[model samples]
Target: MKRRKPRILTLYVTERCQARCSFCRIWEKGNPKDAAPAHFKALLTEARRLFGRIFVDFTGGEPLLYEPLPLLLKQAKEAGLRTSVTTNTKLYRQRAEELKGKIDYLLFSLDGTREYHDQNRGISLYDTVIDSIETARRLGEWPDLLMTVTRENIKMIPHVASIANHYKLIFQINPVFSYFGNTGLTEQDVKMMKEYIAYHKTYVNYAQLRLISRGGNSTLQPSCRAVTSQIVIDPQGRMLLPCYHHALDRLDTEGSLKKAFDSTLRRWYEKRQGTFDFCEGCTINCYFDPSFEYMRNQAALLSLSCRAKYAWLRYVERPIEEAFKNRKRGEL
Candidate 1:
């Protein structure tokens, strides 16, 4: 069998952000430098050549802080790659129109209701986020919501789901990682999350809900595709092999991009075949969700079945239901 190239690339376009979230340490330690646009373009080109089929995500402390983001997105699209961005939605409100055609998906972070969101994100920007969502909708841009579930905001899942439903946007729920200085979820919290996802699976995007419910440090998996099917690159251009959890095993991107990637791949394979102690207990979704074929466990079967059911609902049932409703209103 041929080795599979990474299918996803997360680019930290810049290091500056407006919000000082309670959980994130990025703000506490200030970012004094931003990645150059030329470096970004070069990296994207090499990335495209390495991975024939790729999805590039432009993330940041806040991607909007980078002025050349539009140019970068345009370049990636012209290279025949799909592009996406995850933002806090503060700056997007002003530039959604400019970004409408460039980005395939625009993800907004919505932790909870106004009070909850304001409290968790450590800023009074809930109303601004709402405005940005409305602005994107008005400009005919496809916007989605990402909810980082923590003790402070987990109870507001249903409310946030309703907001996504109201806007007809995709709602993605992810549990807060313990590495971020936040308390990890308890057994009770996990149970509540499972129940909530099951209940609202039909109300929002079924695929995303299913992904979130199955997320976290899953013990049923054999290996991860960190270097094979997914990777995260910091703004300074170093690549994180395996995942962000193993941040120490970073490959410098100062020389030949292909050479660096090959070395990283070798390192990843060695880790997998050798002691393999590092891969003992980790279930980061970015590494697991997209690399399901490598998971020889019961959760893999569950993932497939859940995907099939949701795929049918999203592609077959929802369209028919919408058409019926439209015809009933004499609009179809």
Candidate 2:
């Protein structure tokens, strides 16, 4: 019997965003066209049929702005898929209750401290996002904090980890990818990343060590998974994205997800030496790094260990007051 793929399906419900962040290539212009409810229903049906453990992530300029988000999530859950959303958290509070059971995880994009966050996202967004996260925690939603490490906020890494610890939250540290439309990193920005990596090496390494020691794996690693296990469907339902950055660069559809997985993608992964011009100079976590690891299984053990450690921490060491304080301080 053939092994089923471990697939993650992401839907860009809308392109309408309220914040004008400098780093975002996709949300630079508002996405006026959205996937209608009927189309979404069809996509969900296809997702349920094609993969085992269907994981759905609804994203957008702001997915919450999509009028039928709650309904879409409800349908996904009803189909028995693990559902998540990546949002700026500006509309979290208003939709928390409705999303309580439907969403398995709320991945909030939190950059840094209030001043730093507001500067990167928009005016007062940091506070609003913090408040929304706190509320979600209080309501038992257990949201995960996703920090995109950019040149502007790299210095605050330790502080961010401290906040995650305080909030009893699982943190995903993503190095910012330079894409078209976003200002490419300067020498100073590169320098800042190096400094940030050096400064927080202890905490970052320790956390990773602990995670590995406990058997936790990072979902972000092992990049060929996108070709084999993950499928990103844009607002227009175009499939087989090289990466989110690629998808945003143009809503180009190369082939159906099924065809890609069964044909060219399979050949690339199986052969283990193929390269795409698009893969060069790419830093998007959704692709480049994972491809390298998948080819060699370089960090599998550490990844599994880290995941285990995280589970242990979640069950045994998660704190309450600290969690709230972390949010209040904009550390998370």
Candidate 3:
């Protein structure tokens, strides 16, 4: 098996969010302290030293709301690492210029059309998202639109994809999963989602879908790369062990990110990773997505190959058809 170094870093920049979404509860946690700037400074350097140029993703209740986001992203870029930020786009307008060159990839959240998305968000911010999308385009930033699909909004999947199509941008879909006791997905929901993925050329994590049907990581043994391939960090500068959804422990990194990672507690967790009792039924994507590449199993490797094909098709497939149509029109 080829050794996999840490290539992705997920930083929950802040726990403060205003949008009250129906499917998620990250906003309900009120306001938690974001990791100290020093913590990020350490990570920006130490992480590059320990792990080669990692892909850092700044996520949150809404990453744009984090005050230190611009500086942190700038630092990540200066460290010569690729950076990404998955934002709700609430603060895109205010922070746009600040983050212009820092972010290599930017993902915007959408549930469905204006009405459905507004309902799902528990706020009338659908217009806000659209405005942000337009603004992003004006700035020459082509961002991917991500829809968090639930049973209620699953039917609107194609509609949202059309929105992405209308903009000539990439689209992504992720089925809603239980987190922090917020369980709404059912077996029927899983069936519908599976059926939906079968037809759409969008990005789908089959492992996550399979686990969703089995009621979590229950049937599948954890070959997780949660902490191995990508490091999940909490707002207060601690590394979430195993994965974020079923994190049994959090290791602090007050001084050295490398030393703290090498500590007794984290090492123990590393040794027993993916085998923890909670790890049995966990379907967390942040950990599992990166794990696919590091998989040593022959069966998993083949599955990865199929997923990679679709992932490639997702971006170019539609554009190729559009170009063909234009070429035909020109000939006519």
Candidate 4:
């Protein structure tokens, strides 16, 4: 069998964000240094040559705030790569026309009703997300709702899911990581999460919900597949090793990714990921969700026979998944 190439690229395009969110500290980096469009041009070119098939995500303190995003997205498109963006949608309006056809996937955040959302973000922008979703739909783009769930905003899951359903979009929730400073999700929060995702099986990330419910990224064994199929690039053009969750070190991006990835340092981290002292009880979804995968039928069969949520998935969810794929492919 051939070695698997990294399938996903997450580019942190900028380190400056307008929102002062309670859980994230990226905004405090202020006006930091990072790549210009020329750097991204070179990086994307190397990425395309190194990995025959890749999915590129442009993220940031606020990717929409990055002035050269349009040109960058166009460059990736012309290179024959799929592109995506994860944004708060705060500045989507001003860039909507230019970004319309460029983004292949979009993740818009909605924590809860206006009061809760503004409080969590330390900014006032609940209404902006709603309007941005409408705008994206107009442009033939269906952006999902990604809520950062913590004790402060866990109750918003259903409300956000309703927004996703109303707009015909997927709903993804990520539990707060302990290192980001929250005490981690309480049992109650996890219970509520399990129940919601279980009932809303069709649209929710059912597989991820089940994993996190069992304590995400907390096992001792190397269940993570980061080095095998994913890489996260910071704004300064450095790779976050193992995964961005436990960035033990930053590898230089001054050379071709193929060489950097195949380095002995990369090999060491890949083999030793789940053994670190800090890895004992880690539960960062950014690392776990992307790094985990298995045979679909294996889980489906077990769940169909025993789990209530997946029972329905076996009988009814496949078509729903198919329709979603069709919609994602612009067939519906």
Across residues 1-332, which tens digit of lDDT does each residue of candidate 3 receive? Answer: 55457778888888888788887778888546676877887888889988878999988778888888889988889889889988778889888888887888788888888888888788887788778889887886878888888778877877777877777667777767656566646768877765655334466666666656766654256666676777878988888876677678888877778776777877677667777776776666666667767667753665486577655664567568668989999999
TM-score of each: 0.84, 0.74, 0.86, 0.84
- Candidate 2 is scored at a TM of 0.74
Report the lDDT tens digits of candidate 1 across residue range 1-332.
56667778888887788888876767565644577788889888888888864899888778988888999999999888889898888788777767888987678888889988888788787888789888987886757688888866767888888887787666677666555556755556766776666333332322233444444333344445566666678888878765665665677776556777778465655346212455554445556666664556665676567666655655676577668878999963
Error (Å) of candidate 1 at residue 123 is 0.9
Pairs in steric clash, model 1: none
lDDT of 4 by residue, 173-211 (tens): 767767767677755677887666522533344444565
lDDT of each: 0.70, 0.63, 0.76, 0.74
RMSD of candidate 3 to the truth, in angstroms, is 3.5
Estimate candidate 3's alpha-carbon lDDT, on a 0 to 1 scale. 0.76
Highest TM-score against the true fold, candidate:
3
lDDT by residue for model 2 over 191-285, one digit each (tens)? 55545543221212222223223322233322334454456667776663454554422233333445544555544443332234444444455
Candidate 2 residue 101 Cα shift, in angstroms, is: 1.5
Instruction: Show model 3 residue runs off by greater than 4 Å.
Output: 1-3, 184-188, 197-201, 306-332
User: Candidates 2 and 4: which is better by lDDT?
Assistant: 4
